[model samples]
Target: MEVNPLNIFFVKSDSKGDRLLFRYPYTTENKDESKQKKYGRHNPYAINSTEDLLQNPQSQTSNICKGQLSGFTDEMLSTLFAVKAELCNRKFELKVNDVRFVGHPTLLPYRTNKDDTATMILINIVFALQASASHSVVKCYYDLSKRLGKALRHEEKRCSYLTEEMKIMLAAHDEVSVLDSEMNGDNDDDDDNLRHSVSSATYSSENGADSSPKSAFHLILQRSSLARSMKSVFEELSSTGIVQVRINKWVLLSFCLPHKAHQIHNRGLIIEPETIDKCLQKLRPYHGILLMVNPNELLASIPLDSSSALLRLIKLYSPLKSLQTLAIEADLTLKQVSQLTGHLVYWAKATVIYPLCESNVYVVAPGANVHINSPLVEEFAKEFPGLCLLQ
Candidate 1:
């Protein structure tokens, strides 16, 4: 059914001017007279959507213009102008330009005629109306679009001014683990490790009523860097559990936090490795999740007592194996990653999920459609293969 375009503008409350909307559809038309003949403001306007935006496309305009334009909102104005535009060409909707943010709406219809034109036009009473370049919804949409465009350009300029490090880190946050053209260095570790290390800088005490599981992990890593290195890592891990594990460059220096074993014995996260001979054992029957918040102490090679804890970690892990959502921080060798992965399948038995990695892209975008360009994580994916399948 072809409804009069004017009906779209004049709603039930026309006298009150409850509706005020502005719309303009633009097509790229060359200013050159020669080219203009080939491509005038006709079909394929070079816009993404041609259909009427059911909800306000210029929602900000609608919101800003409501009750402000001669008491009409942007929506109402759009309807009115759409009707007027269709009047001349049923298929044509007026596309205006140069509109802007109005602190207070000004209904400056640019229609030409005597002032008496508006006075005579009572929907029931037929007559012409005076107008101006800035009067109708067509003009309003044009003006608003221009204003929005300028604001967007300003924002792009501001983002472009970001420091190189900020740009890299922020961009790296997206497309984190995917191997792509941006990668440049040797990827010795997996994306899982890269994401953890990069994300570590963002931790803060949040406002959740209870400390979330994520916070627990983040808080642990936020400890002093000493606690992150292998020697100190063992020192910190023991405080959390009874196994006082020691580490060396190639192997561990010690294992079993002799002081905390009773606690682990109490909690059953592990079966305390009480003796040098018994502790040298490789497996245990302990049960629970081994939340390896930071494994800087996890040496390249396992020490004697280390086996007992590893066994306990494994035994405790059997049930948690189904939770393969593993997260690790710190650069590690493929060999080191292999040891950890082996245990996940052999012990925890969990299916890994979510790839977390790094991006090395230069910028998110100038103003919009911004995306990430993680480089480190991408390297890890390429270097380590399926190691980060669960990242």
Candidate 2:
């Protein structure tokens, strides 16, 4: 299943107020052009286009323009900040119209150089998903956000990585503001130099080049390890189910979307050791084993030490041979073979059955699906061309 996030935002709060530290896919200069194409000029939230709101007053209160931070309005930001106490140290889901905000708010204790005591800082890494997202997909993104939040908290506690990165981001924000003002004035030469510096810094940072502190403001922000991590989490986890990111160049953290319970039902099975042992002991030497799954697939998941033995067992396995004879041929003790069979059964890889004999009675399993329209019927017909399933 595809689990793509519309946008990602890192919000931080302290005694001052809530601040949007950084967001992925930075707001471009052509935001207005793209906004028109995406939401159309009729969107109430579109930049400088108020006709939609004037025409439909209800939409002004209900609908939000889509794309990046366009949907994230001041009202939503205030609501999030007002519930800071409830949002801290827990998972939060805030829905506004068609957008759903999911995040794990983490509270970290930070200390400054002058002060020996620590102050609490609330940080949340949020993913914006469509409200129509499936429960499983939402859960996956939530898990990813939770892991990322915890990792940042750990890094902040260990080395003040988050604190330092935020400072750099704030500085970059200030630099952008100054540049905007300068560009507004008639200084064509200065504007060209600033543009060149921004592009060069961005390219250098993206290519893993070491950028100095005095580099362009864009470089300072994108050069942050935390920023790169946020980008990686959004892009990688959405495309693939797994993500591995290095934190502050010191620790490597890995997170993955867990498989649903039904996909790994055998792993969840609980059987008493006494019952398993009794079942193993009751197995007759004349009984044969049948593999339910491909041996090659099982070999990939099993340990290397046991893989060779398993392969040998598969090569020697035969429904016509007694358990004792099969074990002898496979160069395995009868007890060892019985133990192996028990493990396979526990994993739902194989099952024990009687050898083929005319005297043996066969019947459909009680839980088997006997419907004529069942896919099993088609498979059976394909396997046996002339056989009549009803007969």
Candidate 3:
């Protein structure tokens, strides 16, 4: 006979926390699970954020309970008991003599050393005895966004390496949204860092409620007033735990596209090259060119002298080994940027993947050189900063 597939469910609760529900089928239910008395609270669905556990929980002192609420909802525990029940039939229970599944959960959010503070979680669930007795068991997990208490099971999601480019892309989209909201008179006091907001107070009473737990302050947050380019990519690096630029010394260079060159000329951020040098010095520790993907493009021109000056400054002060990827278009017809292009394509290990423009795609092997242009000028060079020599 075919077996029912075990399933898991996850729900993020209005940004404040998470609600994770789980269930699966088993050949035999454990004696231990049968003994678990129901929690008598009326709103059992109340989410428990990280703060709830770090601050308060009835079972806080218990090591087993602590283990269950770790960053991930001891997702493995469900599988362990399920697999055991399958193998041992009626005899399978947690804390059994021989556990069949010793391996870890396939999905883990936090790495070994990093601190994971994904707080405020919700897990709504129920279990019951099956009609037949091949020791058969059935479990269910429900999503809150779906029908009330109705189990909604899905195959576990598979995602990896939240890339630096992804971070920038997300930031860019969010920045535009925030800008639109600001224009539309959206209050500065809207949501927190992760876009979570708490609800207002309401009294409960059948016979005219008395005012108790009197409300004090209602706090809300506005979007941070920081430029996306200036939001400190280092903090982003810390959060994502992966880097944007992988610098290789010998291949480092800098160039401007076109319009930004006009911007520099008309509304220059710096009056003289010394001011520019100062800005570069401030960014020197980062060991890379300060860049925008579509800089000089669409503009008039950037004097070769500026590019020459920037290159000399980069070669001298910037971390020589920590430079690659220039964020400008190819405009200059001086020497062949082909060598730079070749190095970028082959050695730099860069593939020009489009996030939103995912319309047309071909899967290339990892560390593959994907060149979209011919031996001449690259067309979509802006999107593929992973390639193209400085203009």
Candidate 4:
């Protein structure tokens, strides 16, 4: 399954304080810049933004719970920064009102200025997932968050990217605050009451109302490079299990979501050297071959620069061509061809079988299930339209 995240938040904490620097699917009530005036200072949810209510379709279904998520995120700041030093650089998890937040919190050394040498800053990349998400799914997202955290740390150390971005975001917040104050004017009392009412109603509800005000403060992040990267990562990873994002023209981050395991293998299983030799002996260059599965996905999981040879080999592969024949056609050596086929089998991309021929004999295993009325009968008929199941 693809990784579907409700939201991805980048939280940073330093000597000053903790703040959410960026969040993906930068949400706001108003999609039009002209509507910016509609959102009063008391109601923080009002903003002029490019995106609609939510960009992610999967996340749109949870629109009703946006307020709960907002409140939970506010509460998460303290929880994320309050952890002991022992818990740093580890996965942090929290569940509230059916939403699960998984984050990797790491403390990295940051050079304060030209004068000061350096100091440690706590930063976390958090992924919001559904409560009923499977263990493997959660694990996949957690792994992604951990990788992102590490990448951010590396970039921060290299060129102070995180620090510069934070400064920009904070400046935006300050500017927005000033504008809000000017627009608010003498209506401060009325706005304060409205704000109080909104906050109180949002936190007290069961289904969770739209906690707009708190989220309004974060609208400044909509134009940030980090926010754009987060949106790209979420959309690409959710649609295809792989994503490549370039940050600040400094580093290119490529990640492939690990395949989910359906069944556990035997931990005690072992193969002796003689058994290995026998298997290798059976794998001969004279044997005809065909790919059991499509090689496109396997190719996508590898580096882009190294996929040309594999692509050529797969294009030339056929049941009629022996391994040696394929090597000659693909302009590769016999050893290289053999090793590629072995890698395919080891990675479950293909299966070694006797080449199909008129003289080849086929038999059913003793343990094979041959139930005539089973669902497999229909599936088999659909797969091979002219073939009889019994034959």
Compute the lDDT for candidate 4.
0.63
* Residue 290 Cα positional deviation in candidate 4, in Å, after optimal superposition: 7.3
How far in Å is the alpha carbon of 110 misplaced in model 4? 1.6
- For all predicted structures, in order, the TM-scores are 0.14, 0.53, 0.16, 0.57
Arrange candidates, best lDDT first. 2, 4, 1, 3
- The TM-score leader among the candidates is 4
lDDT of 1 by residue, 1-391 (tens): 1000111121111232232211111111211343456445666656665767676565232211221112233343434442321132112233223122211112221212334232111111010111222233233222322332233233323432112212232233232222221232335466745744444333323324432123221232233121133224223433442222221122222222322333332343322224322432322222123333223333433445554534344333332332222122223333443355444322222222223224423333344222345554565578698764224
Candidate 3, 287-317: lDDT as tens digits: 3322222233311223344445334322232
Q: lDDT of each prediction vs. the true structure?
A: 0.29, 0.65, 0.25, 0.63
lDDT of 3: 0.25
lDDT of 4 by residue, 299-369 (tens): 56665566577778887777877888888999999888877776565433555566667787878765545
Please identify model 1 stretches exceeding 4 Å from their true place. 1-142, 151-191, 200-391
Which is the better candidate, 1 or 3, if ranked by TM-score? Answer: 3
Superposition error at 3 for model 2 (Å): 2.5
Better of 3 and 4 by TM-score: 4
